[model samples]
Target: MLPGRTWTRLLVCLTCGGVACSDDSQGGHARAHYQETDHPVAGTLEPRSTWRWCYVHRRTV
Candidate 1:
């Protein structure tokens, strides 16, 4: 495999921290993306997100 590609995958996983396991409408599979957030005043580093994936009416959203 390409080293760059592998490194990117690793970064994505690490950046997202832990992947939560659960049954969902997306065929039990889901992915996470980094989100830009700011609250209570901006800072050098962003805080952890409170977003998550779940099934809605048998569909992933």
Candidate 2:
């Protein structure tokens, strides 16, 4: 991990396969990526986390 980029939760962009840290971390890299690319959805990188979030609809899909 990069300095000052500690993260407990990670998210992977479904649209472009971009991986980033979740909002629970120092920087909301996932959300930032969504804002920049409008990727719409991302799934958690946590083990056994079979869930995804839709950034546009603001809910799980």
Candidate 3:
């Protein structure tokens, strides 16, 4: 064994916070990254999101 833990164990600790788990990506990092943020603006939406450009580049013709 390493002074602390084996590399695999260390990675597991960093990823799962130590022992027992469901999703490997089920830890503080996951929770912090994928938190439920539910609060849509009442009634105001652009015809389309500028973010669309991220998924599919747009070209003005």
Candidate 4:
């Protein structure tokens, strides 16, 4: 986490286990990680939020 930022919108890459912030967050690191690595899927890291997104399909999976 950054200096004063919370982990409200964190995501973890399913293909590589890389963690990043969502697009709505400071750096949009999740999308960047997908673009850079061509990893197709990521999932929410929130405690009770269970969802996954496919970058290739551009939808929830």
TM-score (all chains, Cα) for each model: 0.19, 0.84, 0.15, 0.82
Model 4 ranges with Cα > 4 A deviation: 1-7
Q: What digit string (tens of lDDT, one per residue) describes model 3 on residues 20-61?
A: 221222342222222332211111123443311110122211
Task: Please name the candidate that would achieve the greatest lDDT relative to the true structure.
Answer: 2
Q: Model 4 misses residue 28 by how many Å?
A: 0.2
* Alpha-carbon shift of residue 13 in model 2 (angstroms): 0.3
Runs in model 3 lying further than 4 Å from the true structure = 1-27, 36-61
Alpha carbon deviation, residue 10, candidate 2 (Å): 0.9
- The candidates, ranked best first by TM-score, are 2, 4, 1, 3
Steric clashes per prediction: 0, 0, 0, 0
Candidate 3 lDDT at 34 equals 21
What tens-digit string does per-residue lDDT give for candidate 4 at 1-61? 6688754588999998999998888778999999999999999988888799999999999
Ordering by lDDT? 2, 4, 1, 3
Best by TM-score: 2
Candidate 2 lDDT over 1-61, as tens digits, reads 7786688788999989999988778888999999999999999988888889998998999
For candidate 2, give the lDDT.
0.90
> Between prediction 3 and prediction 4, which has the larger lDDT?
4
> What local distance difference test score does each model get?
0.25, 0.90, 0.23, 0.89
